[model samples]
Structure formats: structure tokens, C-alpha cells
Target: MTLILWTALGYLLGSIPFGVAITRVLGLGDLRQIGSGNIGATNVLRTGNKPAAFATLLLDSGKGAIAVLLARHFGGETAAMLAGGAAFLGHCFPVWLGFRGGKGVATFLGTLIALHWPLGLIACGVWLLSAVISRISSLSALLAAALSPVFAWAIGRADLVLVSLFMAVLIFARHRANIARLLDGSEPRIGRGKP
Candidate 1:
């Protein structure tokens, strides 16, 4: 019952849709009508409002981290893991948005950071390096998710491997369309409007 409650709390936090709120509050229009129609930082960047996009990213990631930290504080590592995973699910399939939401990259990284900072930092490094080289947001996210488990294992955090794998799978599942575009070399770059 406690676990269920923590999970619920995590989901609710993750489902806040910071991108939509920030964009709407700033009079940037509806986020859903923008590029890719995603409620993640990358899509928020399409609004041409760097501050709003940055804010959305921080809030989205913060929700996941906060969920994990809160659960850990109240219920130990098990609850923290469950809450973190739930947060990622909420970000990917937010109930408020008819189960359609972001791809879970930011939430994943944030959750990882909360669970283990070193692992999280390594994953972030992977993402940054990939983004710099590829200039593709989806690809960078994919690479980071894909490599998280390996990094966790390398750093002796065997406990994080399974959760990292689970999040990676979900991230891949959510980015199916982006994967298709990437394969065909049609995936859009970071800042442009279209492919």
C-alpha cells in the first residue's frame, strides 16, 4: 500500500506537462500544436523560446529526481526505484494527456541521477557527447539510454542495471517513430522546424 502510494505520487508529479504549462504561460501557444507535437524539452525548443524550453527541461527532469528522492527518504531503495520507474512511465504516458506524453529521456536521466549520481553523470555525458556529434536529439537520447546499463555495471552499481535496462527499453519503444526516421536519415536536427 505504501509502495502504491509512492508510485502514485511519482506518476502525478511526472504528468505535470511542464512544457505545455510553460509555453502557455509565456503566450507561446499550445505545445501540442508545435513541432513533433511532443511534450518534451526538444519539442519545447521548437517554440523559439529558449528560456521556456530550458525551464521545461529542468522541471521535467526535476519531477523525476524529486519523486525518487522523496520515495527514498520515506521508503528506502526499493520504493525509490519503484517511484522512479513510475515517474518515467508517467512522463511517457501521462494520463492527463490521454496516455500520450514525452519520450522519457529527461525523466530517465533525472531518475538515474537521483538513484546514483555517478551513473547519472556518465549517462548525461554520453548524451552530451552524442548530441554534439550527431546533432540529433532523439539519437542522443537513444544512445544515452542504451549505454546506461553498461555504465552502471562498469561503475559497480549492479542494482541499477535492471532499472536502467527497463527504462532503456521504454525509451526505445517511445521513440519508435524517431528511430524510423533516423534509419532513413530523415530525423530532424536539434533546432530546425522540420527534417
Candidate 2:
């Protein structure tokens, strides 16, 4: 029952589309029609609204952080990790947004940070490094998520490894398009204002 509750809470929290909300509120029209039409920060940036993009990123990350923190308070470490992972999945597959959602990058960062501070730091470093080197959001996210589990393993975070694994796999699945673009040398750059 507790697990179910945490998962549901996380999902609902994740479903709160910051990009959609902010865009509509700011009279930017539906964010879905702009850029890559994604509900993530990167796409929101394509609208030439830095504040909106930051708000989306911060809110998305905040939801994951809050979910995991709540689970920790209500249950334990394991439950916290589970809730965090659920939030990531929800962000990647929001029901309110036609079951299609963001690429789960920012939210995953939040989850990892909440689960383990040092691990989160490592994940962030890796993510930034990957993005800088590859210049592709999809590739950076894929590498970061993939490395998250390994970071957990290195830090002796046994409980978080499972969630990291799922997150890594799920992100890869969600970024199939990006992966294809990556392979074909047509992947878009991060600050290029989306596809």
C-alpha cells in the first residue's frame, strides 16, 4: 500500500507539466507545438524563454526530489528510491500529456541527487561532461543515466542500483529517436533550439 501510494504520488507530481503550464500562462501558446514539441526544458528553451526553461527544469527536478524525500520520510531508503524512479518514469510517460512526456533527464538527476548526494554530484559531472563533449542532449542523457547505476555501485548504494538500472534502460528506450539521430550524425545540439 505504501509503495503504491508513493508511486502514484510520484506519477501525479511528475505529470504536472511545467513547460505546458508556463507556456500557456505566459501566452506563448502550447509548448507542444514549438521546438521538438517535448515537454522538457530543452524544448522549452526553443521558445526563446530562458526563464520558462529554467522553471521547467527546476520544477521537474523538484518533483522528483520531493517524491523521494517524502518516501524517505514515510517509509525508508528503498521506498525513497522507488518513488524517485517512479517520478522519472512518470516524467518520461505522463498520462495527462497523452502518455508521452519528456526524456527523463532532469528528473533523473533529481532522483539521483536525493538518493545519494555524492552519487548525484558524480552523475551531474558526468552529465555535464557528456553534454559538453558530445553536444547532444540525447547522448548526454543516455550516458548520464547509464552511468548513474555505476555511480551507485561505486558508492555502495545497493538500494539505488535497481532504480538506476531501470532509469537507464527506460531513458534509452525513450530516446530511440535521439539514438537514431546520434547514429546517423544528425543529432541536434543542446542550445540549437530543438528539432
Error of 2 at 115 (Å): 0.9
Candidate 2 segments exceeding 4 Å error: none
Per-candidate clashes come to 0, 0
Task: Point out where model 1 deviates above 4 Å.
Answer: none
- Please report, in order, the local distance difference test score of every candidate based on alpha carbons: 0.93, 0.86
Q: Estimate each model's TM-score.
A: 0.98, 0.95
The superposed Cα distance between candidate 2 and the true structure at residue 15, in angstroms, equals: 1.4
lDDT of 1 by residue, 52-100 (tens): 8898889999999999999999999989998999999999999899998
Q: Which candidate number maximizes lDDT?
A: 1
Q: Write model 2 residue lDDT over 147-195, tens digit each, in one string.
A: 8888888888877788889989998998888898888888889779544
